[model samples]
Structure formats: structure tokens, C-alpha cells
Target: MVSQVDNVITIARPSETPAPRAWQRPFLKWAGGKYSLLPELDRLIPAGKRLVEPFVGGGSVFINSDKHASFLLADVNADLINLYQMLAIVPEQVLTFARRMFTSLNSERGYGIVREEFNAQRIDSIERAAAFLYLNRHCFNGLIRYNLSGQFNVGFGKYRSPYFPQEEIKTFANMAHNCVFMNAGFQKTLALAGEGDVVYCDPPYEPMPGTAGFTNYAAGGFTWDDQQALARCCVAAHERGARVVISNSTAPRIIELYKGHGFDLHHVSARRAISSKGSTRETATDIVAIL
Candidate 1:
């Protein structure tokens, strides 16, 4: 059986049918990654010739879903895009350099040194990309934050052992063969959408009330005006015959923004582990809007 809400289609399979195993997992541990919401996201995604992700945070949704023949993944973060580009061009080299860095710089002091080098822009692209991966794994809570001066500023993670995702990197490289990654903002990426495209956006979520909203994934944090602009872009893409799906916090303003644009909202519980304190981490309501 199947159900449709607006244009969003979801399959209701027989109880006897076994769930499909995840095809791939993202190597990076991003803050707002969609790994846990794959089942819901996959159901909402409509069939299309290509999948377009304007905010490809961790590359989990694109990596796991096999519905699209090609992908256009974009993000505002240049370092993240450079890492993906390098992986697509030279997976083995990235794997080798990252493996070495993980082994050599697996301490707090080493982390500080590498963070300094990465911010200083002293290393080549390949090495810098490796350092980015290393910092993402070893830094606190896998945060990719930067200061106003555009320097990597997250502290040491202090993990017992950060696993080197060799297989995950290789898997992403193979998948990247049909992908085009760009270092661009959501507006520019969404403007390119047209017929036969499915745009899935996982932007830095709007912070709920009474919570310290952590939108500073990049230097210029996402603002209310930016969120409004994103909503406008999604509506424009939908009007151009493309399917659009967006994930965001269930903030009142966020809900009102999507509702006003005629998007169908599907709320789901997402366990957020980005909090500094473990006790503060709990299940939060997230809305997946489709048009």
C-alpha cells in the first residue's frame, strides 16, 4: 500500500517484507546529519532524473538513496566541498593522507597544532582536505565551526579512539562518480532546479525558543532573513516542476513559513546529540516539508 500527502509519496509495505539494509553511510559526523531520518526522507523523496541537495551537510541522504541517477550536491562551506571534490578525483590519496593524520594527530595537543595549520592556510589542498577530515573526527561533537576570522575554532573531542572510515570513504568515492559538488549557497543551487529534479534541503535548523541556537557552522551564521529567502527559493523551485523536501526544526516561525508556502509538513522525532551536556540531549520535533 502507498499514501500520498500533497505530492509526497510513502510506501506501506507488508509486515513480512524485510527492511532494506542501508546502502552507504556518510564518513563525516555532521551536526544535523540525516542518517537517523533516512527511512522518512526516502519515503518523502519523489522519483526524478536527478537529486539536488543545496545543503549537503554529511552526504548521508544522497549516499543512501538509490532513486536518482545523478546528483548535484552543494554547500556554503568551501573546505567541505574541496574535501568532496578531492575524494571524487583521488580517493586513494585522501584515504592514505587521512589515515596517516588520524594515527599521528590523535591527541589534544596534536589537534591544536593541526587546527592552527588548517586555519593558517599553510598546507596544500590535498593535505588541507585531510586535515579537515581529521579535525571533523577529533574535534568536539564533530563540529565544523569557524570564528569571525574564518578560522577553525572547535576544541578537541577527547574520544578514546576515532575510527578511520576507510570503507565509508571508498564507498562515497564510487558514488561520487555521478555527482557534481559545488561550493555555493542554497539560493544559487536551488535556482538551477527544474523539471525532473528533486531538491532535498537540510539547512542549519532554526533554533527553538530558550535554546542557544547553534547556526554558526560557518562564519556568517544563518539568519532569519536567510531562512525567509530559503523558503522563497523552495517555492520557486516547486513552481518550476521540481519536487522539494526540506528538513528544519519545529520552531513556530519555521512551521508558519512552510505552511504559508503550501508545503505539506510531516513531523518526526529526531534525537539531537549536539548539546554540550548529555542530559540536555533529547528527542526534538523536526518537520520534513514536501512540495
Candidate 2:
């Protein structure tokens, strides 16, 4: 059935929604992260042996939900995947380097130096992963944008003091045992979905009118063609016996795409902190489609 509801909010608290269980917060701050929308998503996600995410932005779904026995988390960003790998492999070492960076390199000049070093790839894998965590906290709005050349190009956030998510990092490290991180695009990742797997997709939202979309989480930005292909892929996975759920902007085209595919769509207001200023922060209309 095709369904659409405006300003629907299932999540308990808009400002701070506590998880049913202990919160497994991700270290990185993402633009369209699912941390706040977990309650609405949980209502839509079906039972499955494995939880698969093709566009695991900040990993809020997998980390928070205990419904799945295992998780297959994949993203197009290699650096992000690398950070997950390092955290899974060497938690203490990552914590050590990240702690040092957070304490010592908290300045705009320091942030610039680290950003250059991160792009240059001069450091080891563990250190590079730690550097990414540092950049995420200090960068403007915690954005991870890359230029056409694949260089991290976000400006420094002039926050008085950026927070160091040590507990969040440790929690992620502890939970990494049950997750398989992949540095792959959504196509490759969604192809792995099958019977008894619940695939949750949080792809970059289709840009709203008069606004340039924030699709540059990696080198090559996601495009309209990519959005169409992703919808097709989700449909294919659903046909293959996997229960699929997707989160995207309530853009006319996006709503039409899911409706045409026979998805059950629920519209909700998602609070976004993309803007640096408090007054500019607003609730955006987003859709949760179950297939």
C-alpha cells in the first residue's frame, strides 16, 4: 500500500531521544545521520537474521538495533570504511592516537595541517583512521566532503571546544565483532542482500528545490542517476526476498520513485543540524519507505 503522512514523529523526544536499550552512539557526526529517526525506522524494520546497510552513514541503525544477529555495513567512502576496520582491529591504538589529536590539535591551524596529512596519506592506517575521527569533530558541521580530486575539503568549525567521543568510540569498538564493514558502493552492497536479510538504506537525499544537495560524502558525489539506480537496486533486493527499508528526502521525485515501486511510505519530520547557526537548524520532511 502507498502511504504518506506529513510531520509524523514516532520517535519519543525530538531534542534527545533515548534508546530503549543502551545507546551505541557513533563517533562521527553525519549530516543525514539516523540517530534521531531510530524509533520511526525501528517500527518499519522487519525481523531478519542479518541487517544490511548499503549507505551506513554514521552506523546509528546497526549500532542501536539488537534485532539482527549480524550486520553488513557498507559505504562508498573508503576512508570511513578504513576507520571502522581500524577500530575493529585496534581499538586501544586508535583511541590513543585520537585522544592525542583531540587534546593537542584543536585549533584551526592544527585542523588544516591534519586535513592535509589525511589527504596526503602519509600516516599509517590506524593513525589515518584516528585523524578522520579528529576531522569529523572539528570540521564545519562535522561534514565529510571531498572535492573532485578526492581531497577532504571541509572548513574548520570554529567551535570553542569540540567534544571527544571516547565512550562512543569504545562502544563501537566493542560492538564491531558482529559487523562486517565494506568499502563498497550501494550497488555492490545491496547485491549481497537476500532471504532473511533486512536491508536498510540511507542514501544521500535528493536535493530540494533551490538548494544544492549535500552528496559529497566521497570523491564522486551522488547524482540523480545514482538515486534512480539505488531505487532500482532496492526493488531488486525486495523481489529477491529481502525486506528493504529506505530513508530519503520527501522530494517529489523521490516520493514518486518509491510509490511507483509499490513501497509503503511514511513521512516524518527529521531534525537536522546541518547549519552552524541554531536559528537556521530546522526540521526537514523525510520519508521512510518499506518494501
Candidate 3:
């Protein structure tokens, strides 16, 4: 039997690149996510410890973080969390669903039908992963916003035929397999860590006076109370000897909120919006390297 490390991709087959370390796709397209900002985050990784990312948005850090830790990944979005849980625990099911969705795509109507069909089913990982993919690809600019009723609220994208293949998705499945997946709110995940663990918090960004329209993706926008709660979680984690890092909009509200909260706040510039016409959104600073 070939092990997962076997660097063998048979002819007529690709996309099975052997991963020296497990890397899972961050299952959601978070509005203010920083998958493209890992270089900025690289400066802040603590030398060695088990790793945890409470927000784990698109898993930019969890999947790419040096690969030397007992990872605990969590998110608040149920379907998003379920998709990762499925990828970690059930890759084959996800692959099957991906292929089926690819073959079934004919029109926007077909995509909506599939979403409704899967959304009504029991909380199965495979179906959830496929639905998540479909929404991300078809939804406006890959935003994962939803309606208050829990229906995906992202409008159809400009793409005509959207398809995710079996081989490419297997990578996501293996990622889920490599780490522990959770549906807990950010605090619950933090509560599980201790001295030898490292937690990277990528909570949703807070809006500032000049850039108030930055966060509008999730069904219910994240709140100031949640931000305070996250800061407390980080402080508690710190007291337990764990290192905490946060990537969020460096707005005055956030900066003032965490000032002297025992964290070193550093500002790094980031693009503020993802709108059509590629809206020349404001370039704003976000912070990391929380001490």
C-alpha cells in the first residue's frame, strides 16, 4: 500500500503532490481574510509550540505555518466549520461530491438547486464541503456572507461554469485530517490551549471612521463586545504561557481597545474592500505581532 508520503503521481494524473506536511485549504472566503498576507504574519511566528488559530480564516496561517505543531483549527461559521471538519475526517466523500457538482453544473439555476438540496440534508461533511466550494466560487467575489435565515446570501458571480475537481479537493481533505477541527466560537478554542501552544487570532476587522464599510461579509457582522471578549481570551491564553497573535483592522477603536492590554500592537497595511470594479478600496493598516 502506498503511504501518503509516496511522491508518486501516475501518468495522466496530477494534483496529488506529496505534502511533506499537511496543509488544508481555509474552507471559507472571509471578507477581510489575509491569505495573501502571510509574509506579514511570518515575522510574528513564535519559534516552537503547538499551534492554534481561533479564527482560522481560509487557513492562511494554519496550513502554511512551518508545519511543526499540534494544530487545533476553529471557526464560527457552521457550514464553514463543517466543511473543514469534513475535509479533515472525510476526503473521499468530498471528492465524490465535487465531481458530481462539476458534472451537474449547467446554469445558475442548477447551482442554486444544488445549494438548496445540500443545505436541506443532514450535516454531512462531504455535502457541506461541496456546497461551501460552490458558494465560494459562485458567490460574489468569493465572499461567504449569508442571510439571517442562514441561507448563503452571496449573489451569483460572473463565472459561467464553476467546477472543483476531485484531485485538487483531496488536498483539502488531507488538511482536515492533519489537524483537529472545531465549530466553537473563538473563545472556546482559546480555552483549550496552554503554555506550549501558540494561538493566532484572525478575528473580523473593526471599522474605523474613514473605512467603516470594510466588514460586511458574515450574516451578522462581528461586534465590539466580541472583540473585547477575544482580547480577554488572548490575555488569559497569555497568562497560561501561550503566545497569541492577532491580525485585524488597525482602526482607532481596535487600537484603543487593546492599548496596554499587555499586547504589542503593530500596524501593517492591507486593502480594505473587495467590491466590483475592484473598487479602489482604501488601503488601511492592520495589526499583528501582539506581544
lDDT of 3 by residue, 84-184 (tens): 77666766777677667666764578777766775577546677777777777666677776677667766667577654545545655555555887887
Local lDDT at 229 for model 2: 96
Candidate order, lDDT descending? 1, 2, 3
Query: lDDT of candidate 3?
Result: 0.71
- In model 2, the Cα lDDT at residue 199 comes to 96
Model 3 spans with C-alpha error above 4 angstroms: 1-28, 119-123, 161-168, 210-219, 279-282
What is the per-residue lDDT of model 2 for residues 1-291, given as tens digits with 9 covering 90 to 100?
234469564544346665565456678999888888877877789879999999988988998887899999999999899999999999899989998998888899999999999999899999999999999999998998999999999999977889988888888888899999999999999999999999999999899878898888888888999999998999999889999999999889989988999999998889987888879889888999998
Per-model TM against the reference: 0.92, 0.91, 0.82
Candidate 1 overall lDDT versus native:
0.91
Residue 260 displacement (Å), model 3: 2.8
Q: Candidate 2: misplaced stretches above 4 Å?
A: 1-22
Q: Candidates 2 and 3: which is better by TM-score?
A: 2
Best-performing candidate as measured by TM-score: 1
Ten-residue stretch with the least lDDT total in model 1: 16-25
| Alpha-carbon lDDT, every model | 0.91, 0.89, 0.71
